[model samples]
Structure formats: C-alpha cells, structure tokens
Target chain A: MDLTDRPDLAYDVFAKACPSRGTLEHVTGRWGALTLGALAEGSLRFNELRRRVEGVSEKMLSQTLHALERDGLVHREAQPTNPPRVDYELTPLGHEVAGRLLTLIHFLEGRMDEVLGARERYDTARGGR
Target chain B: MDLTDRPDLAYDVFAKACPSRGTLEHVTGRWGALTLGALAEGSLRFNELRRRVEGVSEKMLSQTLHALERDGLVHREAQPTNPPRVDYELTPLGHEVAGRLLTLIHFLEGRMDEVLGARERYDTARGGR
Candidate 1:
C-alpha cells in the first residue's frame, strides 16, 4: 500500500509494512548515527564531516548524506568557489529528532557501566571467561 | 581489538569498530525492533510471540531471541510440559532497556503526524508528488 495515498493517516514506525522502516534504517545506520551525532555539534562540510566520523568510506558518507538530505532531515548548502565548498546541517525537524537521538545516546552512556558489568558476569556465567 | 580484554571499558553505540554495534544491530534488527516491541507488553510463549509479531518467519524470530537471550537482555524459561512450552521475559537489565525502547516507540507515535506531514512536504519538494 502507498503510504502517500493516506495523506490524512499518521505514520507509525511499528507498522509492519511502513516505509518509515527505510527512514529508520537510514537514520540509525552505522554511518547515519555518527553523521547525526557529528552534525549535532553544528554544520560541517562534506569533507569535514567525513573526517569527523572515523572509519566511514567516502562512498558511504556521500550516500548517507544524500539519503538524509532527501529525507529533509539535513539541509545541504553549496558555495560556488574554487574547488567548491558545501555544508550540511540539520533542519528544524531534524533538530528535534536529533535532540531525541542525543537522548538515546546519553541513555546508553549512562548505562554503559552497568552493561559492561553485565557483560562480564554474562561471560563468566557462560564459561567464556 | 578484543572488547572482552578491556572489561572496564564502557561500550558506546557511536564508537567506531565497537562490538556494541553488533548488539545494536541485533536489538534494532528488522525483526529485532518488532520482537522487542511485541514483548514489551508481557511475556509470551515462543509460538505466541511469533504469531503476535506479524511478517516474521520462524528463523528470524529464533535468531533475534537468541541474540537477546545471549546479551542477557532476555530471560528464557522452558517449562517441562507436553510438546514443550517456553516463555520469554525481560530481565532486570532487559526491563530497563525495554523501557527506553518503549519510550522511543511512544515518541515516534506521538510525532507520527509531524513526520507524515514532513514526508509529504519532502515528497513535493523532491518532485515525487
């Protein structure tokens, strides 16, 4: 079914066949999470963002950024200059989502200690120690 | 590098090359998200859970539950009964994480309207209209 057909219908992430799943995959992707977190600090050029987020291939970086850009979560600014310069920043909606995303990151950080301890206990219990 | 070696080191989801990325993938898998959301309500038998979560095959459900169980996030209880009956519930740790997971689901639900509107606006802007 076309989600667009139901313009009045609200989008639920939990829906089995919702296209939002693709959006979630894009936003929560390996590079996407890092990109979002990096951009959360402020806007950055494509190269700058690539450098800030370690272990990302140029192709993946460009692709992720494009996906985010297409979704309207990211705004891309291009400057006509020598060698070209571009910047990426969050949209208003992006800012709100990023705020919640940061909340998830913070929540994970707060529980890191406990999760680590549990991992150790788990390893020992499973005879992996 | 072995994350197990650094037992004291906390796991960050954003950290590059971190094993926790694997955990996140498992918990946030296509099936994983659905499984967690389904189990949030209460414990369920394996068959029951599989049925409750639509569009999931037996293989994926088994794999996702196994991963959760291994990570100490889910407690699997097998009852010695005819034809074998099993129940799955969140551990104390699982309860904490699942609470946050539910919060995410709820947050998405509340913002479903704005997201749909954004999607429509995005489609129009992108000439997908």
Candidate 2:
C-alpha cells in the first residue's frame, strides 16, 4: 500500500509483513543512523556526508542517502555550479526521525560506563576477559 | 584495552577500531532491535521471543540474544524445574537503551504514510508501481 501518501496509517514493526519494518532497517542501519545524526546539525554534500559519517565508503554513503531520500526523511538538491553542487538536508520528517535516533545514540554514548561494567562482569563471570 | 572496566573510556562510533560501533551494530541489527523492543515490556521465553519477534529463526534469535547478553543488555535466567525453563529479561541498562530504540521505532511506525508517499512518488517517478 502507498503508505507515504497516507500519513495517518499505523504500521507495526513486530508484524512480518509491515512495510515500516523495511523503513526501520533503512533508517537505523549502520551508516543510516550516522548519516541522519551527521545531518541533524545541517546539510552536507556527498563528499561532506562521507567525511562527517567517518569510515563510510562512498558506495554505502550514496546508498544510505538514496534510501533516506526514498523514505522522505531527507531532501536532495542539485545546483548548477562548476562542479554541480549537490547538498542533502533533512525534511521535516527527517529532522524528527534524526532527533529520535540522536537521542538514542546520545543515551548509548553516555551510558558507556554501565555498558562497560556489564560487559566486564559478563566476561569475568564466564572466564577472565 | 578493557573498555568494559573503564566506562569512562571514550569509544568513537566513527572510529573504525571503537567497540561501541560494534555494540551499536549488535543493539540495532534487524533482529536485535525487535528483540530489545520485545523485552522492554516484560520478560519472555525462547519460544515467546521467537513469536514476538515475528520471523526470526531459532538460530538468529539465539545469536541476537547472545550478542545482546555479551553487550550486557540482556539477562538469561535458568530455572531448575521438571523442564529446564529459561527466560530473558532486559538489564537496567538494557531497559534504558530499549526505551530509546522504542521511541525511534514508534516514530517510524507512525510515519508510515510519509514513507509510503516517498516510495510511491519514488516508484512513480521511475514508472508506475
């Protein structure tokens, strides 16, 4: 079903047939999360996205942007310039989604200490790490 | 570097060598996300987890749990009884991370129309769906 056109519909992630499942994958994939987090502050070009996301290959970055764009979370603009300037900016929906992902990421980063402790204890319990 | 012992140690997700990057993958992988989301509400058995997570195979469900457990996000309890009973529950840290993932998931599920619209437009721009 054309879900994008109808913003009022609800899609459950738990359901195997839900299209949102695919959308979630696209949004939260390794590079996708980083891409949105990087764009949260402002727009960036293809090369700029590559640099900001750090360690992402050009092929993956391009793929991530294409998926995000297809999901309506990001907008791609091409400008007439010597090098054909292209920049990606978050759409309203993109901004909202990125903010949520960023919140999760920040929480994970902040709680690294707890995570470390858990891992340490976990490892030590099994056998010395 | 025993990062788990020193929670204060900074692990950049952007850096290739950082462990948090791998942790991120484990926590947000296709099965991982759903598994965490499932446990956030309450505890579940192996069969229940397999059910709640939709199409996850037994091998994948166990693998996801194992990774999450290694990361200190899930706790497996073994109950001695006539039948060996095992249940999985979220750790405190797991609770926090799962909440964050849930928020992002809810947002995606709520925005089905926007995603569907993007796909529809995307598909139509290429040719009718």
Candidate 3:
C-alpha cells in the first residue's frame, strides 16, 4: 500500500507545541519542495511523482506525502482498480501554500548568482573574523 | 559576547552537500522565523530582538543570528561605544529572502482559518481511517 494514501497524521499550527513544527518539516522537507512543485502542475501517480522529484527515497517520499496529507495540504485519492492506482493533488489550502513555495523557489533560482556572491563574502569574512 | 555578532559559520546553498542545509536550518530555524521577522522591521539590537520575538531563548536567538550572519543573510555591526552595542540588519540577499519569508508568513496568517478547518477534517478522518 502506498503510504501517501493513508490518513493518520494531524497538524496543528496554532498550538505552541503542536505537531505543527513536524508538519512544517514535512511540508518544507527536502523532497517537499519538489513534490509540491510537481503537484502544482497536476496530480500524479506515486512513481510519476518520484521521477519529477529527483534524489528522493521511496521512504522519504511516502513519509512526506503522509505528513502533507495529514496537514490537509495534499489530497490522496486511491482508485480501486485491479492494481490499485493512487494519485495526489493539492487541496485548496495546499494550493495557497504551494503558490508561496513556488515563489520562494523561483526567487531562489533567480537569485542564485547573488547568493553565490554572498557565499564567497561570507566565507572570506568567516575565515578572517 | 553576543553569539549573534560573531562571524565564524559559513553557508553555501549551492553545494548539494554543504553546511548550507544547517545554515538554512538557522535562517529558517524556528527562532530564525522571529529573528528575520524582527530584522525586517529594521536593524535591532540583540536584546530588542529578543523582546520582539517573544518566547525565544537566548541560546536559540544567538544560534540563529550566528547562522544567518554566516550565510551573509544578516549583517552584524558591533559599536564600541560606552557599552558594547551591536545591531543586526538584513544584508541585501537577506532582505530578498526576508521579503519572501514575509509573504509566506502573511499568507499563513491569513489562511489560518482555512488551515484550521483542514486540520479538523484531517484529524477526524485520520481517527476513522
């Protein structure tokens, strides 16, 4: 069974000590950026998602999706066909968050040059100071 | 000495495997959230930042600033006046990052209701499923 299709985790952003932090970790997790990027385009099967998001382990992908699904950001629909097909999409709220995340990603990619420069200065000053 | 003023850590976001991730941890770290939030308003002294962020421990705040400074996302200047006065501000790159972060924060705050609703459904369905 694809763990992404399971619904068990619950995220609470309001509470100070809620699972919200963990949920944030999952949503912004390393794979999360890629997963959300793919979902923003459209729903995809587990394997399809895996391809779109490179460098993700099957276990991490499954765990990330479970966490996102638990937060009600991503929706997981399982089709009961002979082989049991599953697809994932963003919920309305997920779309909002995805929009912001995409902005961050695009911004990061756009500013890669500046970030590179900053890294150099940071490294030099760090060594001296 | 305020750990925030020290320049030792270095962040490299480009490298697939570098201290970048941990630096990201510091910049986006839990307190990193508040630190950036405060710095966005304007350069602030460490104590002032501590007051504005609310509920942040001295250790976490210091660590967060140290990380941000290493990444060149924050500029720390120590004034050698009567008492050692230090102020922190966002570097140009930091300002860019902080802008996007603000967007995310505002978006999250605005969608709190929807996110809360999603949380409820997630919890209920999770219990049953």
lDDT score of residue B55 within candidate 1 = 69
Docking quality (DockQ) for each candidate: 0.33, 0.69, 0.20
Ranking by lDDT: 2, 1, 3
Model 3, TM vs. native: 0.74
C-alpha RMSD of each candidate structure in angstroms: 4.5, 3.7, 10.2
Sorted into a CAPRI-style docking class, model 2 comes out as medium
- Taking the tens digit of each residue's C-alpha lDDT, what string does model 2 give over B41-94? 999999999999999999999999988998889999999986899999999889
Q: Relative to the true structure, how large is the alpha-carbon lDDT of every model? A: 0.73, 0.88, 0.70
Compose the digit string of candidate 1's lDDT tens values, residues B24-97. Answer: 66556677666777788799989888877766889988988977877767788998999888999877877766
lDDT (10s digit) by residue, model 1, range A1-129: 775776535555556676566666666667776788789889999878888887789999999988787666788899898988898999886776677666665665556565566667767888985
Q: What is the TM-score of each candidate against the true structure?
A: 0.79, 0.90, 0.74
Q: Give the best candidate by DockQ.
A: 2
Ten residues in sequence with the least summed lDDT for candidate 2 chain B: B7-16
Please report how far candidate 1 places residue A65 from its true position, in Å: 2.1
Give TM-scores of the second chain, every candidate.
0.86, 0.91, 0.79
Model 1 ranges off by over 4 Å: A1-9, A116-129, B1-10, B116-129
Best by TM-score: 2
What digit string (tens of lDDT, one per residue) describes model 2 on residues A1-129?
A: 895686555589999999999999988888988899889989999898898788999899999998999888899999989879999999999999999988887778776667777788888988975
Cα displacement (angstroms), candidate 1, residue B117, comes to: 4.4
Worst 10 residues of 1 chain B by lDDT: B104-113
Give residue B57's lDDT in candidate 1 (0 to 100). Answer: 88
